[model samples]
Target chain A: MVDLDVEEPNSGLFVKGKLEETNPVYKMVPVWEKDKCTFCGNCQKVCNFNAVIQLHTQVLVFPKLCHSCYACSELCPTDALPMKPEKIGEIKTFHQDNLTFLESCLNIGQEMAVQVIAHTNKILEKDYQGQLIIIDAPPGTSCPVIEAVKDTDFVLLAAEPTPFGLHDLKLAVDTMRKLKKDFAVIINRFGLGNDKIWEYCQRQNIEILAKIPNSRTAAELYSHGKLIYKQIPQVKQEVLKIANKIRQLSGEPK
Target chain B: MRIAFTSQGSTWNDPIDPRFGRAPYLLIYDEETDKLEVIDNTAINQVAHGAGPETARKLFQAKPKVLITGNGPGGNAARVLENANITIYIGAGSLTVEQAYKKYKNNELKNY
Candidate 1:
């Protein structure tokens, strides 16, 4: 029931020269008490991610294995476990020229990305004053991705034109269908390999949101951690066009 | 506390038949009397999905403080039982309710 209303600027959710901020959303994780811990290994046993482990003398926890399910804390017999406050991560608002960028960093060894993504979602779900929010999601259809899509206006799935890309994209598509989230495809690296991606999208009736050609310049710029601005203006322009198309699909004005 | 082993029959009135659903009887172990009474989940026969959450709730509500069952409650149902602080013995399998209760009393059932 915590209120998540924060503003993130630009992020391409708004038109050029428009100012914005994402709403603030808070995400929390559970903390454990070691005193009453009997090293019973219950948490380790139930955790699907191997996030918890028990050694000869003590139980060990890997934050990455934690899905933040709270099953362990709830099932603890000795009242030795408690929910501790944890900030999984957060997104920062950045502007790369006319494009607003949402730079999100998951805290090192953080277990739950969903919480942080949900917090980010709070901003996107709120009043945008007629702007488009482009979400660059972490790959995978698990809890993290699911949580990211919650409250999204629309999902523009970015996939490369490759066999592995097709495989993962199908899984992502299935997840979107299961979640009933409306989504479109932005097939990057067009003209690289096969037409299987196009055929699959056609079979599924998924709209082609946009296509980015397999450009070496774009790839090089990305590899160097440089923004699209560092690359040729056309590359930035193509991404902006994709952003505009996303805005149109989202039914947002200008 | 007499705990009932419920698998086949609820009451001792009928033969101890190891049957599915209806055959399952409740093992009521009365610690005070030191006598174990096996009854039917018959009291809850009218209820749908017998041996499910509703029955699990009723079993725990009888104030046994612990239950040894072939299966464990899932989702929020499990959470409810755990919140009530009921010690659950999952994987009771074919073990008679009586045998399971004895095992619990002897502290032989390992906790997860």
Candidate 2:
């Protein structure tokens, strides 16, 4: 399983593994040479994000504000600005029995998760292929989620059986539809909230793959950092059923 | 000096639009000639992002000394306008474009 939730990846908690390797991820940002700069304010004028500013004698570059579009360097008449790599995050690899888990951890106060996520995928592309890769994506239909789900074979959307769940589920559905990816819905904490999600799924012709019923035991196991599927046979069976369905849909032999 | 007012319509009596970036029309009032010219803002409807900055850029090209609007030239737009040495004035809500212009000439509106 690859955990692409660079902002807050927690899948490492579920598996007992040996820390194998770690590597830092870096992104390019413009570095200005003051002596070469003429204070023309051309860089400032061209920057859409206000990342560059010129004040009388000096040019200021805000590294965090920069999107690293290379526009400033490309447009600079004096060739004063040069690109430099700045460390944004780290990728860690863990080894457990037969499964290899890769997780990307973004540095605190960093706003660029997309860079880290893309780097993680690059590592995955180089090292692994033709395996059961389950990506634990960040919860949202935003940029980060798009980065995680892009180029994937199928998407499994997990939601609760409530009004807010339906609202967000609708958003996720819209995103998946726009991306034109094959996807199914899974209701987490089922039998507790109302059946609006089920109704909406039925109305939209979205397949309901599995329902993990709401239970105090599952909650307790999670609180103790234990896998509920490992402790409860029924939960394990439910997970197995979901796995079988995925295998069937993907046309992979189990 | 030329001044720009955010207007819902092109006429002199048109209501001052509360929105700066998405305003329907920009009335460029020339103080010297006492003539008002309308520039339709809705022409650039295909912008995916940076509508405020794009509009500000267009206004900057018009060489307006001052921009009189109801609410905002948001952070991005404000930066571009400031860079171009154009001053922004606010508090023209529920007033006509002509009324906003008159208030500005009389130094009644608050400068942002």
Q: How many residue pairs clash per model?
A: 44, 0
Q: List ranges where model 1 is wrong by over 4 Å.
A: A1-64, A75-78, A95-101, A123-131, A224-241, A252-254, B1-112
Q: Can you write out model 2's per-residue Cα lDDT over A1-254, one digit (the tens) per residue?
A: 89999999999888789999999999899999998898888987888765676645666666666778999999999989999999999999999999999989899988788889988888777778777788999998998999899968899999999889989999999999999999999999988889999999999999998888899999999988898988888788779888998788668887
| Candidate 1 C-alpha lDDT tens digits along A1-254 | 11122122122332233334433324433455777887776865565544444443354444444566777778878755566655555565655466665555556555455667665665555734356555656667776677767666677787888998899899999988888888889888777878889999999999887677777887776666566544576556667777677657767664
Regions of model 2 farther than 4 Å from truth: B1-112
Candidate number of the best lDDT = 2
lDDT of candidate 1 at residue A20, scale 0 to 100: 44
Error of 2 at B26 (Å): 20
lDDT of 1 at A135: 60
State in Å the error of residue A125, model 1: 4.4
